[model samples]
Target chain A: MNDYLEIFNLKKVYPSAKGPQTIVQGFNLKLRKGEFVTVIGHSGCGKSTVLMMVAGLSTITDGGIVLAGKELDGPGPDRGIVFQSPSLLPWMTAKENVMLGIEQVFFTAEKEERELIAEYYLTVVGLADSMHKKPGELSQGMRQRVGIARAFALKPKMLLLDEPFGMLDSLTRYELQAVLLELWRKNKITAMMVTHDVDEALYLSDRIVCMTDGPEAGIGDILEVNFPRPRDRKAVMEHPDYYRLRAHLIEFLEVHAHKKKPASTVPAASPAVAVAA
Target chain B: MKETLRKLDFLLLPLLGAAVITGLWYFSSATWAGDLPNPTKTWTESKPYVLDPFGKRGEMDQGILRFTWLSLILVAKGYSIALILGTPIGFFLGLSKTFTKAFDPIIQILRPVSPLAWLPLGMVLFAKVKGVNISEMAALFTIALCSMWPTVLNTAVGVRAIPTDYMNVARVLKLSRWKTLTKVMIPATLPYMFTGFRLSLGIAWLVIVAAEMLTGRPGVGGFLWQQYNALVYEQIILCILTIGLVGFVLDRLMSVVERRFKTA
Candidate 1:
């Protein structure tokens, strides 16, 4: 596959009192044009850090990221991001919040055209009626929808999502995942999302890059998800290989991925022993 | 009927408090403070000013409302200047650590100095300028200088307190520095800035009274001083009441404006 986006040996080292603490090292990935990839790992595994580096929101201490044949530097409008929090400007209405980025990216466009662009994306995200409402007035799910719309409105060469639905309830998460997939299908934008949910990674990504536990986390394994395009939720769950992939992911997380304690460590006492004590 | 009674209680409670204060004042005037005029005597002697608020007998002897209006105009001028100057200083103070470090000590030191102290400096500075009302200029300068600290401090605090999430969004959008300020920083900091403005206006109103008295300008404070000199204690009380009422109204107006901007 053509390397539309390449992250080569990306590393992050934060200085601590003891010494330089390397959170992520030897991290590398490549994405083809219009491909959807998800980085899955436990909490604090530097998955988001890796995504942040790729988006150019965080400084890379070592290595490099090249997107669409251009070397990345500081953040630019070429890469769109959806943060875990909606991050909508509270003062602006949903349409105005979306219009903010649209104005920046499409500066040469007419004012009415920009307004229409904001309106159209907000409408597509199922916020047509509440397009004029501020983020404070909207539900958490609706606010995230606006965030998704804002990212897509930029029409960036790459889309980076840092645990975009990590804060939502399961139902809201499922609904937003559908909304995201629908938008991705239409735009065919090269997208990378960092998530902790196994089912979410399974449903949305073409490939899942799992990271080891942190304090120097690296790619532990990569699983290709070739469940075919235009995937229906029910069909994907019912596929013959679905249980196999699910068990494989669960096993990696439960058994192989966690930091092992030394054999000299003693196990805790039973409930009765604690009560007697 | 119950809701109406609750609404009535809101008005009634304050009225009761005022009546109690008035009763105590009357008792004190009738007993220990024989020189002090009773409320009834004060009302009777000040009736002409109350009845014809805008009446003008001479330049300095105008009706009480005219004096109050003059004070308000002075305060408005000074408050506008304060906001105009203080807001940008506040933005810089909040945005740049170096700027804050260099100037913050000076601002803190200057902020606590009274408006009365600033008056002589203002007079000396305005005395050299040509073709302007010197006393008015000095009064305006003193008022502006005294009132600007709150706006500057609150604005700096507000700008510094902006959410990290918003800044991150600015980064991802690749917003220009100008766009980041206008679209993100300004809007986010507006509520706090208005809080500063409201406080600044209150300070301006407060300083105007003292400034006017020292400047001997045609304002409520000047009228109060003039009444004291003329030995018309009732008129002094009248001027005091007028100043309090106008200050209350100005504060209410500012709070209304502050609420309108606190959309977030």
Candidate 2:
């Protein structure tokens, strides 16, 4: 499959009084159309920095990203992002928050059509009952649900989720994971989610891109998961290779998470490691 | 029973305060400030103006309400002008660091200036214009000049305080400059703007009395000044009380509006 989204030689550097501080260097990734990819690593691994760069919320200091054969410029409705926090407008209702993006993406559509689009997505995210509530009035999980609904309602070519369920409880996280998977299964939009959650990466993504810990973080390893489509939590957990794959992910994280190396000496290892078949 | 007592206390406390203050005033007037009329004497002397607020006898002897109405008109005109001018200046200040850096010192210097000082400048400036009410125009100019700072400062602060997350959302949605401003910036800045407006209106009301006193326009402040010159201290007191009451009411109205915006 041709690459639907390509990020090449990505680098982020911030100037400091001491010297230049390099956060991420020589990062590269490619996603085929409709691929679900999650970048996982320890905290402060610059995973989110990479995601923000792709989302065009952060400036790219070096390298480039090309999505759907178009060189990315800045943030646009073509790319939808769900931030770590819900980031919904506090004054706007849940439906209004979703409609904010929908109105921009579907500018040519009629008002009723836009309303329907917002309503449909909010309902899909299980916010049908509280669609009129503001972010302040909603629970943390429900707020993130609105955020998810907002991103999906845009119907963008790519979705970038920066730990969308990071603030939620485990139960809410599981529920949102189901909601996200259901949406992704239906839409099959190319997605890149940044997370530190191991099981979350395993359950949701086709490929898990792990990064070495930062100040100058790069892709430490890549693991492919080939669990059957429309995966059930019970069946996947019960699968024979589940613990093996889970062990491999945990082991890779433990080895590379705290190990810092100079950027010049680190080789760019080939990342096409199919750990599961 | 406890809740009812608390509610009663709300009304009773202020009434008690009024009574104590009136007693103190009567005592002070009887003792040291002998020229200052007692509360009973003030009410008697100012009764016609208080009871018949809308009466029209002559230009100078018109009802207290007529003078108050005139002062309110000037304040309304000045406050409106202040909002129209100050709101955009505030947005610019909030949006651009360069603009703020250039103008911030100037705003700070001008913000503390009294309406008394502005009144003379207004008179001199409007003195050049043709066929306009010089005193009224000077008074309006002074009120607007003095009152606009709160609105401008508050609005700028409000704009600057918009969450980075909201801006990120705007960028991700690729909203147009206009849409981003109208949808995100304006709504986010509204509560702050109202706070500024509330303060601005308060300042405008405060400035109007001083402005009217200086310009000798027929308003509450002018009435006070006129009564002072005429040796009718009771009517002066009446004007002062009216001004305070009106100011309190205006502030309450602005706060109500501000609260509505905050929750909306």
Best by lDDT: 2
In model 1, the runs with Cα more than 4 Å from the true position are: A17-19, A256-277, B1-7
User: Candidate 2 on A58-97: residue-level lDDT in tens?
Assistant: 7889999999999898889888888887888998899988
Docking class of 2: medium
Q: What is the lDDT of candidate 2?
A: 0.88
Could you tell me which residue pairs clash in candidate 1?
A: none
Model 1, residue A187: C-alpha shift (Å): 1.9
In terms of TM-score, the best-performing candidate is 2
Interface RMSD of every candidate?
1.1, 1.0
Model 1 docking grade: medium
